[model samples]
Target: MSPSELMPIGVFARRCGLTSSALRFYADSGLLPPAEVDPVSGYRFYGAEQLTRATALRQLREIAMPLPGVEAVLAAEAGEASRLVDAHVAKIVGDASAALRKAADVMSSLGGAPALPIAALKGPVLADAVEQVLTATAHDPSLPVLGALRVEADLEAVTLTATDRYRLSTRTLVPSAPPGRTWAGTVSGDDLRTAACHIRRSALVRLEAGPHGIWFRTTGREDRYARLLTEEFPDHRLVLDSLGTVTGRATVSKEPFLRALEEQPGERVELRLSGRAVEVRPAGGRHPGIALPATTTGAPLRVRFELTTLHPAVSTAIGPDVMLDLRGHDQPVTIRSADRGDLTTLAMPVNPSHGPRR
Candidate 1:
């Protein structure tokens, strides 16, 4: 190859987004040796053809991939390389979660706060409730509490609730053992999500609330900690109390209801309830609606909702059949299992005037 085809270390480092020292270190480590080295001058030169590999190496290092992992990724095929990167990321995330839990423990110890026993619950049941209710949490920079799950525990039951303004989901779990005392706090949703996998496998989980966080002491697995948020959770109980009486009710098979919603076109959807069926349609009359069989009572109603807000509320119901209690088009619709009342979701509907985006 011509001399012009090779770039000196300084120029090659600039092109590959790596410093000259980094290039020298990698070359010394046998990871990215230069294309050519001048014997007399003792200088390194990289060919233009090596730029792709150099760039990939830089990216892998940017993600904090260890040297061995980076080397493996650089040598692997495209699909294998992608999988390796994903595995590295998962490991980093798991490590970070463990670090945060350790930090929380350290802080509690430093502050000399005792861990107060909160409640003991079945691990599988707690895990299920966390997954279902956390669907209502939203991540917003301004209101961090919206991304938290409220834990309220008493002697009989522990209730988990989350709301993203548009939708609210709540699940009540009867503890295997009574709580030491009544307790309520907003626990970080992210932390709970990280700990959910371990929580699911354990036979039992004892919740202990500390001054700064909550600890999930499992029967056989590693204990996990969830930081407690100081922000005030939204007054969901007020909304529940203020709700008007249900004027229309419908019970439909969960599968068909979800399918109808999935097949419905546009971002905004309309539901017309009359007789023993509920019709799902695009908001702007662009397509004919599909009717699903339902058990109906009370007055007929026409309601509108953003597909984003409504689908999750119905899909998260616990049982095969879902019941919708509609007060009015303007009111929030109550969705829950037709047979079991433990899990309930409230979805706010859009105005009838809202139409599909142009």
Candidate 2:
């Protein structure tokens, strides 16, 4: 194209919603080079065709995509570009959420004073229990307490609980402890994950809680501590008790069903139990359906759930098959390993009127 056909940098930036300097920087970085340049005047020019790429670059930068990632996204085909963006978003969300949780724990600790140890438990057991329910913890900054794992211990058993309002999970383990010593506290999920890693590598683990912070120490290993969340946890027991009587039940093979859900392209899906088969399909009636054989009882029922919320419960189920206890269309569904009574995951079903998104 001739020089007359090329748009000046100023005009191009205005059309692309970018500043001239930003366009120049992108050019310097080889993201979007000028179509032509005046050697003597040092003026840059861009083709009108570059507007689409420039706008996309601006959006990618707005989301804080790294330079290399941006380049990869630009270089990819349409389908691959989408996958790249999705992968980057998932990683950043996970990392930023963890950092926020850690920062919140630190700030809470600084606000109060420290206390002495109160309870102890086995390292491996605690690690396993925490891992089992960690996925259920809420990561929302507005509700700090919900982002924590509630640790409740007594003479009989030690229980770890986490919930994201929409879903609740609890893992119970019998603890080897001295009688009459009981304790309850909420620790940030990020801190618990870190402590669990150290605890699993050690032979013994001890827990101490005070007014300000909680400490976890492993025999022959480094210790870790974080500020406890002082906000009161929701009465989870009441929520559990409030669940209506089981109106329907289904025992489905865990792996195949979980795989089918993972492979689904929609954000929300409908789960229907009819006779001895479970059918899964996109909520908006777009994709082909998947059917899996299951052992069902009580009644035929259909419910909708956000794929994000339902996948974790199915993926974490321990046994070969999982049992679903359905109360009603509006009630939360209780999912438990068919063979294990120690762990349970409850996910709230989506309203049918609100169709699932792709």
Candidate 3:
């Protein structure tokens, strides 16, 4: 038998969030064959070590990826599924945003400008969600509750977006699926920014929205959502997309890269934009080429980059590595680890003068 992580069928079922019968179904279908079968008692045994892979399989199922597709993704080297996930998030975010804009325009025409309370805004984003909002709001503070913002939740996720315009950042939701599927809600961007500071990651939030001001009261908490003008936010998508010039590969530690971008007194490096390597020389030093596990079919690439703009790209990593997408360059390059979620940083190339060129 192939060496594999195994667990008893019953124990594995609870961890995988699948029923024993369903596991048997997987084995029957040859989707996930168990390690061994008990001859005497007619029972199944799964390797405990396979739990992570099994759980990943279930998550893919939750997202509705087909069985064959799911198997293909899992069977590939790690991070393949994560890349698929990032692509999915981008596509969905775009489609959902369009639907939301249409819904807002309709609401405006009907005379009911939406008002999303601070409470409603707080619930949509999960851990590090506050950090997510703060990244965009760092330059501006003191958000006021506008009341007519938008909030939405589809089966797999939820979203909070405000269109005060100069900038818009949407907090994409993952499945928390607590008690309130019925608690579908919305809130202004300002309310969200202001309130994120006090919102508890573990508490259930109750929302009350009206023409006056929205109220976000938790069952046993003392938190209030922050409401700020969406107008103050720069068109972050555009801003983020338009940043930096020249693109190339730079290998660095995920932890250091994260801190360098996220912490104050941000790391300053003299960007020596070369054709291939975008060398990330720290203020005090230079590190070796960060050899990473990867899956790609290309020549060893080196390039130059605009050091200033790489920070935001690095800090926003939901995973580990950055998918450095370089347009406007001699050739566009996308880099990441062998596994999908392994990359957390993403960089986009800009025109020489810090503006987007097409």
- Candidate 3 per-residue lDDT, tens place, 1-358, comes to 4325556798899988888987888789777888888789877888876677778878877876667877778777668867877766666665654465455445445776465432333353442554443332323234432233444455555554432222233455554343234233334554454455455553556554434334455666653432323333223356446555533344434555445434333234322324333333443344433233332222344333334445544554455544454433423233343244322223333344444322
Count of steric clashes across candidates, in order: 0, 0, 45
Better of 1 and 2 by TM-score: 1
The CA lDDT of each predicted structure is 0.91, 0.83, 0.48
What is the full ranking by TM-score, best candidate first?
1, 2, 3
Clashes (candidate 2): 0
- Estimate the overall C-alpha local distance difference test score of candidate 1: 0.91
Name the lDDT value of residue 265 in candidate 1.
Answer: 69
- The per-residue C-alpha lDDT of model 3 at residue 246 equals 37
Q: Return the candidate ranking by lDDT, descending.
A: 1, 2, 3
Q: What is candidate 2's lDDT per residue for 129-195, written digit by digit as tens?
A: 7887988876777888878999887777778899888789998876556524678988888777766
Q: Residues 211-279, candidate 1: write the lDDT tens digits.
A: 888999986678999989998999999989999999989999999999999998689888999999999
Model 2: residues >4 Å from true position, as ranges? 1-118, 178-180, 354-358
